[model samples]
Target: MNLHLHGDAIPEGLSRRARSFVASHGVRADATPLEPYRERWLALGVPGEVIDRAVAYQERWGGLVLPPAPVYECGPRYLYADVPEPSHGGGWWFVGGEPRASVAFSFMIGPNGEFGLWGDTWAPLHASVEGWVESLALTHHASQWAKQVTRLHGDEVEGLSLDDFEPVEEVQGIVDTWWRGSDSLVALHNGEAECFSGRVRRVALVYSGLDKWGLHGQ
Candidate 1:
């Protein structure tokens, strides 16, 4: 997986608010060393290759911006005790994103180098840190676009299916990112829809509601 280090570059097609958020808090080109965080991952027994890739990602991008939320952070035991285990066997280590918000999105890295998004429930997002970064950048943009649509067409959007809006095609090829169905649309549920490229089918309905935004894996 090729890493797309978005050092201070606001992804194209984000709203003014989203663009401003990215410009203000996007990853820094001159990021601090992540060596200090290695011990934390090592303590959790994260695989060496996963540690290396994750650390290298942070070093290059400084941190990720999933806006409306703060940059992703890494540390020991960042996962809340409440977070359930993934169905697979690997030990889960917290990657980043706000974990305490009413609608939170937290990332977890598995021992086998798998990455998952914990929002309402755990869903495998990417296979590696590089893939995760690319998917996340696209997710952030999609999220901002959703917010813009909500503000502009709130009432009209109620009960409206995602098919009404054009399918977002820019995020293709970011591994583990696109929804499985070819005709998937961002269906409005409770006033929001998690319209991104690679969202899984099971969690698609749950993600449509904005209320589920920060309810990480609950």
Candidate 2:
């Protein structure tokens, strides 16, 4: 997927010159080193050998230059436009509007395009929301706060159906655990409609990065 960074100017405090160049060139936000190779191989149903080639290319060539600081706009739009932190391998995030429904992030593509993805959702780590939260090690007090939010939103709402609601609950459980007694923040929308902005914040909390886990082929 191609990533698109939209704003009048790239932020001033970007860390890497490379990322600045990327933004200048209009690189898609979700585009990553392995994308081209992955697309090619997936179309052909080839073996994993090509992924290795892609990784090598990234190691030798791929780098990001990021704008400094988180950029915010009116209408509840947020752009994670800081220079890609080496701590997070410079993965960028572009979250648009309230009630968010479209989002993507970078992924690791093995040689020949074997890839690992990190985003709002994933399949393999399919734990219920409660289970997921418990896994993240919340403070004892925070768990209490989280419980209130969870209880309010969990299975209580009417006509609530989400493909990842269960998993999100797991995430919420974790966030609640960590956030309790910290004056962290909580906002809930009444009625059956999910308070999607809150959900988006929950997802962003754990987004250390998309392409950091040796996707470039360690």
Candidate 3:
């Protein structure tokens, strides 16, 4: 399937907020500038399919200096897809990154062409770059719409009430995951917070108020 359609999968309002967030805190580049990098990857023997998805993402949603929502309370992060290089995995290629500096992980295209993060290990964050963007957008949406927003940290994240919530598969998180409920969406993150912190710093944002399009769209 074409994974690039994530931009269309999320609710329009959420996407708008995501764009606004990026505009305020990030730098977006015209995808056309990626043509040279695409040619370079091809010459480097990167698989055609891998290059396809990565190129599409860079062209569309790629950016730089993007920090996660303040609610996340994680380290500084950004989306910078400069050039492609072979990853430790045979067919994957280093494409970008989510976090920065010491705890940072490079973004890559997985064997099956999935958008992923490669740190000390590899973890697929989403099916596509736009999926990651959707997760970011939903963060703002859920936080604003929920009747009550709850922030859980460390082991407290384990006690979160996720009994009736459903996984948000489109976002396709490995360390990070999103859940939807009758009136809420829970965003659980283990990236820089839990996994890399060397401590149980897991975090979860529970957004509870989807009485309208939030529930209906999905």
Candidate 4:
């Protein structure tokens, strides 16, 4: 897996949009380290590996919102993780977003570091916090590199063919998905849709006619 350079918490694999997001919208002050929450998390029996990931995530992208849309033309689209709360039904813990789902005002993270909702849906959007950041960055930059961008909604999203495309390991999809091909890329935004409304359950982006650099998402 690709990582950020020395001293920079943001991953180098992430897109310029993701960087700008932290720059423009992130809180000016650095949030307190997750080390303080270590004991509490351990008390919940959260795996040591998962706790390490969360602490690392806090240092890297904790306060910054994880936008659902690739091209973010709006604010407060997704909620970033915050302090953990035991006030949850399942084994999941409240990490970010709210119960209402308007934004990251309240959301939950699974024992394995999956970013998700815990209410009626109880679904994870990304396999892990790292996956969410990588996927968001991919969507923002990949769209600009493509020759064409296609948006799919409703049943149409499931109709598309991804013959040669493979799952982008950077994003381990749970409710959402990302696929890559020789000349194209696909991003599904069911995470946001499911949290907002469980009705349609279809939101995909197809970036085709990509150049060599676009294919790799430089």
Give the TM-score ranking, best first.
4, 3, 1, 2
State the displacement of the C-alpha of residue 121, model 3, in Å, after optimal TM-score superposition.
0.9
What lDDT score belongs to each candidate, Candidate 1 first? 0.38, 0.27, 0.60, 0.62
User: lDDT rank, highest first?
Assistant: 4, 3, 1, 2
Model 2, position 86: C-alpha lDDT score: 18
In the order shown, what is each candidate's alpha-carbon RMSD?
Answer: 11.2, 18.2, 6.1, 5.8
For candidate 3, lDDT tens digit of each residue in 80-155?
Answer: 4555566565665656555544545555656655555565566665665656666776775665566788778877
What ranges in model 1 sit over 4 Å off?
1-32, 37-44, 69-87, 91-93, 100-105, 109-115, 119-121, 125-169, 172-218
In order of appearance, the predictions have TM-scores of 0.40, 0.18, 0.67, 0.67
What is the alpha-carbon lDDT for the whole of candidate 3?
Answer: 0.60
- Name the runs in model 2 displaced over 4 angstroms: 1-20, 23-48, 59-61, 68-120, 123-198, 201-218
Q: Is candidate 2 or candidate 4 better by TM-score?
A: 4
TM-score of 1: 0.40
Q: What C-alpha lDDT, on a 0 to 100 scale, does residue 183 get in candidate 3?
A: 79
**For residue 54, what is the lDDT in candidate 4?**
63
lDDT of 2 by residue, 116-182 (tens): 2234331112122122112222212233233232323333432333323223232233212212122
lDDT of 4 at 47: 58
